[model samples]
Target: MKRRNSIWMIILVVLMTISLIGCGTTQSNLENKEAPKPTDKVTIGFSISTLNNPFFVTLKEGAEKAATEAGAELLVVDARDNTAKQISDIEDLIQKKVSVILINPTDSAAVVSAVESANKANIPVITVDRASNGGTVVSHIASDNVKGGSMAADYILKTLGNKGNLVELQGIAGTSAARDRGQGFHNVVDGKDGVKVVASQPADFDRAKGLKVMENILQGNKDIKAVFAHNDEMALGALSAIQAAGKSDIMVVGFDATDDAVKAVKEGKMAATVAQKPDLIGKTSLETALKVANGEKVDSSIPVELELVTK
Candidate 1:
């Protein structure tokens, strides 16, 4: 009888052990099944040179739309055209611990330090509409400024019959857009003997400055037949100055086919304008930033398309 009891006890103990093990396994499975999954949302930082300009504003809108569509949070800061402020803004973004940073530099060279800082923090940088002169940039999203400039020059040359005294209203002095556009325009006009650039002045990419500078140029060079301003704002300003001076025969060309510039082209007030898709640029910049954040490869330079708009 005692031997029989021992056998039964052994069986009971074995059953209890198996039951405990099975219960532990089930609990672990339940715990794992109830656990939350890792999140895929990422935060992006966008630093713009200025929101004052309509082009930049449109660019910002596109970025916001892209961020929303990608399910990423976007933090935007405006530099207001101040390089120092832009650097500070970028530093602030670093502190926020953004996954990636997209910047439209106030000045290409001046923003290098900011980009380097981002690099040190291991945050990838993407540039839009303008490029940084220094630091590691994963991608640059912008229109082909050189080509657009050449197109503008070609239109001006064709309109003027390759013979005219022209004035160039330049954009910001150090920006890549200004430099490339100026180079491209000069490349064509400089070789032509009939076309003479009467005056080229930096209007700082501002309408008021463009008007004032153009007015000053007009006072000295009265026989100007055509004008090429780096951007539509400056072009419109030059147009205002030209109209004020009572000049009717001068053909004006501008870049950035903004709403006002397009209307001007339609109205036959301006001869031509370069159409850069700022919205596409902004959207692409954000998309590239997301790719960088997600450990994906991106092109160093992404050229957005440019078109020439004429009346």
Candidate 2:
């Protein structure tokens, strides 16, 4: 009877042990089902000319948001409009093994070596609103600046009745937008007999420089009929300078269609401004970047349309 009792006790303990083990596994399974979400570990790098301009600030925000949405880390570095600094920034990001790189080149042609290095490292590059000397990047996204520029010139020339002495304020010397817009305007103005380009100078796309430069031009030239500023900030500066100089006869054209540009157009402070949809550029760029990083086919080129605003 004692032996029978011992056997029964052994069976009971074994059954209890099995029951506890099964319960522990079931609990573990439930806990695992409620485990924390897995996050993707991907990093992207962005190097812009500078955040000194509001347009670039918006662009950064778009890129950051897009990266976060796709569960990636975005590393942004501002080169303060310096070519060497920009190249170094890109190299630093590359060393960190950033999966992708987006650069807004300070000097369009100077970033080529950095791009080639990225290619050798098997990393892809996306250029935003600028192009290198060689087509070394996977994609280039920007507005149709040449067309926008042409529109500005056309509007100015047509409104002035095809006869005006115009002075153009250019942007940063080597940037693609600066070159394209200035040349695009020249394309229209230089061909016309009635339109005379008086004096053109680089203002480095600064509002204060535009004001000072315009003031000098206004003082030096009495027959100034119009001004084409490469950017709205410069245009606004020129408008202020004109008001100060008591030069009310000159019509002013500007680019970038920034909020101030649009407001100036509404106020008739500027004759016309070419508007580039900067926000849309950011949005499309981020979308394309995600596609590129995910091994999906993306558009090699995305062109943002430009509009001319006049009041």
Candidate 3:
């Protein structure tokens, strides 16, 4: 009986050990399960060439709205159309350790250094509405300026019947928008023998400067049939110059369908203007930047749609 009782005791001890071991194994399995990914917040940096223009203001608003929707913070810096200031602003963004950087360059060539600095820091850089001439950009978001420019040219040709003296009020000197738009316009006009570009000058994409330049051009080229300015601000300036000169027959075409430009078109004061979706450009750029920050693949060039606004 003693031996049998001893055997029973041994059996009970072994069963308890087995149960404890099973419990330990279960606890170990629970502890070894994969952890959920962190939900750390991210911040994006946006640098604009200038907020003075209504188009850029719209762009900024779109970016802000997108960042909010994506649960990210945005830090915006306005360069006020100054290249040096733009570079400085980018540097400040880099120092702040933003997850990504979005830039609308005042000068394409000048922004290259700022982009390079971001690249060295391993931060992705995205350009909006403008491109850098010599930097490593992850993506570029903009309308097809060349196409928009060509559309403007086509309108000018049709309006003038392929024969007329023309003046071009250009944008800033070193911007990709200015260069690409000018190229597209010239591609069409140069191919046609009837249209002659009598005067072409940079108004620095400013309304007041456009006015001054157009006034000077009018003094010399009184037979101008049409004026094509890079942006609506310049176009409005040219329109003022034309009105002051008593030239009611001259037609004006501008890019960027600003509210005033659209109103002008409706009022029969301007012939036509190209409509670029600034809000779309801004939103798309911010979204692309976020993707780039997350190690996702993005297209190097994203083209927004453009429309020619006419009366």
Candidate 4:
């Protein structure tokens, strides 16, 4: 009976040890199941205003190159200058769980909702070139458009001897670029007694539109001496119209020193262009996005350098 009792005691000890070991194994498995999943890679979503423009194309290329160098994935979506499409694109990027988002807003006021959506998702947003009027943007990387406009105005004033009739070719009506550039130009040209802005019209930042608008303005304002377009696309269009009308004497100044605009300037067709360094903006935007993803602090507003390209 004693032997049987001792054997039962040994069995109980073995069973308890096995039970404890099993419990430990179960706890280990539970912890493993509860562990957070790791991401395979960082993905950046770039919502461009329009890839149709050469400037934005260059910007995309710059961003792509940087993404490749940094081992990050870049997904580009073109809004085609449509605000609705841009908003939709941001929503899709959010659904895809992109690590970061870079937006080149088509319209400042209209893009607010989309930017706010990203904010709600707790995703960082960086604006390039154009700004959004409302949103929780982590950083904004763009040229000082107002200063650039002033630069163009100063050059135009000097060229025209501070006395001439000017035509202002505006960008998309609601864009910050258009508003700020116009403000800067007017800051200098508004009260000037010598020069007058005879016609200020919107070309919607399109080459063809610029041509048509300028053509219409030229019909009534043949005395125009200079043209200041909000962008190279409009400036080039205006130049085309001016050439067609045999108004070779009118000097044209444009922004966004695009390839065609730079060439025109070198050829003495365009008086000057503001160089926004779009590629650098793109590159810097990607870099900033990465920093934000890493939980690094960045400035709320980042300004890219600007230069005036002239003949």
Best by TM-score: 1
Candidate 1 colliding pairs, count: 0
User: How do the predictions measure up, each by TM-score?
Assistant: 0.88, 0.87, 0.87, 0.88
Q: How many backbone clashes does candidate 3 have?
A: 0
Superposed on all Cα atoms, model 2 deviates from the true structure by an RMSD in Å of 3.1
Q: How far is candidate 1 from the true structure (C-alpha RMSD, Å)?
A: 4.6
lDDT of 3 by residue, 1-311 (tens): 99999999999999999999999999999899887879667889999999999899999999999999999889999999998999999999999999999999999999999999999998899999989998788889999999999999999999789999999989999999999999999989995787799999999889999999999999998699999999999999999999999999999999999899999999999999999989989899888988987889999999999999998
Any runs in candidate 4 off by more than 4 Å, and if so which?
1-40
Worst 10 residues of 3 by lDDT: 33-42
lDDT (0 to 1) per candidate = 0.93, 0.85, 0.93, 0.93
Which tens-of-lDDT digit does each residue in 1-311 have in candidate 2? Answer: 99999999999999999999999999999988976778667778889988887678777887787767778788899999889999999999999988788888888888888888888898889999877766468788998778877898899888888997999999898899899998788888896887898889988888999999999988888999899988887888899999998888789999887787788779877888887777777767777777788888767778988888788
Which of the two candidates, 2 or 4, achieves a greater lDDT against the reference? 4
Query: Which residue runs of candidate 3 sit more than 4 Å off their true CA positions?
Result: 1-39
What lDDT tens digits, residue by residue, belong to model 1 across residues 1-311?
A: 99999999999999999999999999999988867779889999999998888889999999999999999999999999999999999999999999999999889999999999999999999988889999999899999999989999999998778998999999897899999999899988996888899899999889899899999999999799999999999999999999999996898999999899999999999999999989999898888898888899988999999999987
Candidate 1 segments whose C-alpha is farther than 4 A from its true place? 1-38
